[model samples]
Target: MVRIVFVALANLLILVRYLLGLPFRLLASRHRPTHVRFRLAGDPPYRERRRAPLRLRLGGSSLEPATVSSLESFQEALGLLAKDPRVKGILLELEGLEIGSAKKDALVKLLTDFRAAGKRVVAWAVSTDSVGYQVMCAADEVLLAPAGRLELVGYAAEATALGEGLARVGIQAHFVRRGAYKTAPELFTHSHVSDIQRQTLEAFLDERYAELVEAISRGRKRSPEEVRALIDAGPYSAQRAVSAGLVDAMCSEADLPARLEPPRPEEKAKAPAESEAEAEAEESLEPMDTWLAALPWAPVKWRPVRRKPRLGLVVLSGMIVPGKGSGGPVGPTTAGADALVKAVRAAGRDKRAKALVLYINSPGGSALASELILEAVQRVARKKPVIAYVDQVCASGGYMAALGAKEIWTAPHAIIGSIGVFAGKFEASGLLERLGVRRTIIARGENAGIFSVSRGFTPHERESLEAEVEETYQAFLGHVAKARGRTKEEIHERAEGRVYSGTRAMTAGLVDRLGGFEDACRHALNLAKVPTEKFELMTYGGGARRRSLLQLLLSMSSTHLYALCPTCWGLAGFKAGEHFDG
Candidate 1:
């Protein structure tokens, strides 16, 4: 009751603040002109610069949040620019842009659409690596600062093995995996990559490298061979990049306006007095976000009186863990079973929501947790259509949850598959002896201490664990076969804990189609038989709510089998033991 009262009071305070600021907001909006006019200062003395091209900073700090609001707002701004006649063109200022391959492809498609609308799209950057350069390539014209460099280095998949280090410290990992390719346990059990691990990493790298070459070839109007050659001889200077046709020109931010809009012949002949007047009339460039927020209706929150069929979006990101996982704007996030089940059920119960889109960005986690979420998703699918959209990494347990969806749509570069299971525990008996620490345990059952960290697993215990892992793996295969409408044998060929790119997954019958979030949204609408022109998008479960420290500790202490992919975690930029260390 106290908590509810506090929440109500907080909301009341927010309402009061908004009401108090309304008058000033209205006044500011009324004073700011919708459009500005510029005089050429010659024969055409008064030229209307009604909609000076808008400037947008593509990456950097704006994309730091791993939230739906950030992505949704960016997409909304682009939609506004595409539809608004005042937005003649857009200048992209790119910096510190780092994103996954799937997201990069989605962004490239948005930029491509902007260009297709017959509006000029120019991108400027100081220095950038492969990710930023790939995004910049989407622009019609790519500009680089005079002293900047393009570090167009190739892709690499690296893994760190701590088996030897653990051995030296008198610690050992006892694990049982269903498939040879299920290599997550190798991080703690083996000193180096296994034969299958090497093959998997090499194949994955080859696919990504090919995709990069194709993207650059299409963007820069170069052949695949030419793009490959350029990539091989990368780290080019600004002038050299232009000479090599990788960049349009060596330019600065100040010179961007001239490139976007050429000066008129009459403007070159302007008198000092006329030039000053024209300069005063010219409107200065504003940040895209600032312009969006300054719009008259931006501050207002309105709801439609009439109800309409809506597409429900539920995001499942980060590692899939048991219980209710914790996260916020800061710190790491996890896909908790308890939280997701509740969200899915809520979406299912919403009368206005005609279809559901499961946006998954997980690399899989706890087997039981994944199963619980999958059951919830399947329950919802029975009532309405469910479309799973793979963002970047969706492997193992993540893919298991995706099976509940009626259809799976993935970005071309998304990682998918890995239908396998593994379970293990670390033994520190040797370490305890080395430290001269004696410990005693009394268990009622033979296998009661099976998961104890004090001792390693016995032969009988190992056999029992292997049987359980095999059973889980078989169940995973069965689920995939049923979802994909394929025989168990057919699905098994593509299973064995192996992951594939989105394109390959489609070919392997693991995914239904290759597309991005917007495409998935359209498909959901189509499946729901809702009119594409008018429909509502109701998103749920995207917020990363904070959890108490005690809850987090309890969640972390629990033991269970995991249907996870360490390689996928590595691709997501996490080291093997980082999550536990925190």
Candidate 2:
């Protein structure tokens, strides 16, 4: 009896702890604490009542695909700084961050905006890679770490060639893409860079890198010639950096606080709260950032700041899938085909929507789902001016969905078009056979083999699949031709299972214009003749709630119910940032 009581007590305690910790865990998740710290080491309190300086510290690891979450954190920090009245300026430390030139440009752009808001930005670096220095160049004052090394090597890129790797694994890759520029499969087929892939990738990087250099030079008050000379000079010491005017001063991290100025006398020597309730109140009194709060669903905070007329921008991101869910097998959360259709219909039904902009950023999935989304877009287009914006990448079924719009807009670097269909089964029969795992039969017909894992496809099965691909491809071409008012032949010529950049798409009549999401919205507004001051901009993803608690709990209860699609699987990991990492 005593043993049973002890066991019951242990179970009860476990349950209580779990229940009590739930809310705190959620709160902690909502409050993403930055691991990057700033030390106010040895600064003297200000004597002045006003114009007292504040010491800010910036520290973070290299932001990249691996640590991509930091980008969201940085964005939140920017928003906080934008509205913080107490902040006098930003202290940027660029040494620790390992980012590419392109990413640096984006970070620099944010810093420039901060500076433009009447706040000074002082950056210090112990060592600066050629690309990393681009960010430091944007600061009001760039400082050097006394003992830091600065490597000024120019731009270059490296890729992991997979042909040999795959060969060792006994996998033969066949490349069937049409465009020479469509080099996606080359990774598995070629041991070295093809002249085409090398030239294209290099040319593309050169253009973007040059643009960044020019932008940085102007921001740093240096001529392009000076910047170019520095890049060509290569590795330099901190002293050399100071002499070259690349940095304002050389100092150690310990001396940073002494150089900073706080805001006012009251801001310094602030009293600590004595009571826990007071501490709690101080924390709760902090202004919550709506953007940060809405990051889970890619939230947008658009105010009528200037009463700009807003076109209906319906973003159909992610793979096209059936039902009333979001996300599919791969990529970001997407509206279900049915839900998207409803949204499109509602926008058309509302006179206030004025015009519609269908923004697509998907890798394409599910033939039936794509067709349904296409139908929805077509339904909307019939009533009002509809435009399609392809950002980052839109291919295969993505291109199929874009056919619903009257005009298509894409970025110069955007990957658009892949008018094709592909459906293949992964055959594991040979491996299973080698492993002596023979299968016992229990199928109704030969067609059952269509989804079997036991064997490779027969020649007849290949023909049937090819026929299906061809049928889907032709249907895709028909939609493009009809929407763009082009001849069937014209679309057929461009729609041979190929991908093209937005600019090339425009030249080949695949896309009507070369522009970004904003451009697409502007076009829709113009075509609809809706003044920019009329409508309030609204978005879908962030506000749409996930499944109810009961459903989630029930889902957790069933371990065998694995997600068959990637879209549904990635929804739980949905982040609030633009999906444009090339």
RMSD of each: 9.7, 15.5
Best by TM-score: 1
- TM-score for each of the candidates: 0.80, 0.57
Give the local distance difference test score of model 2.
0.57
**Model 1 ranges with Cα > 4 A deviation:** 1-88, 273-284, 287-305, 327-332, 542-559, 572-582
What does candidate 1's lDDT look like per residue over 218-330, in tens digits?
Answer: 88999999998998887799998999999999987666555666658999689989977765544344456444444544544333344456778777887787777766655
Q: Write the per-residue lDDT of candidate 2 for residues 450-548, one digit (tens) a residue.
A: 545555455665566556655665676678788778877888777655556666778888888875444566678888887753344544332122334
Error of 1 at 553 (Å): 12
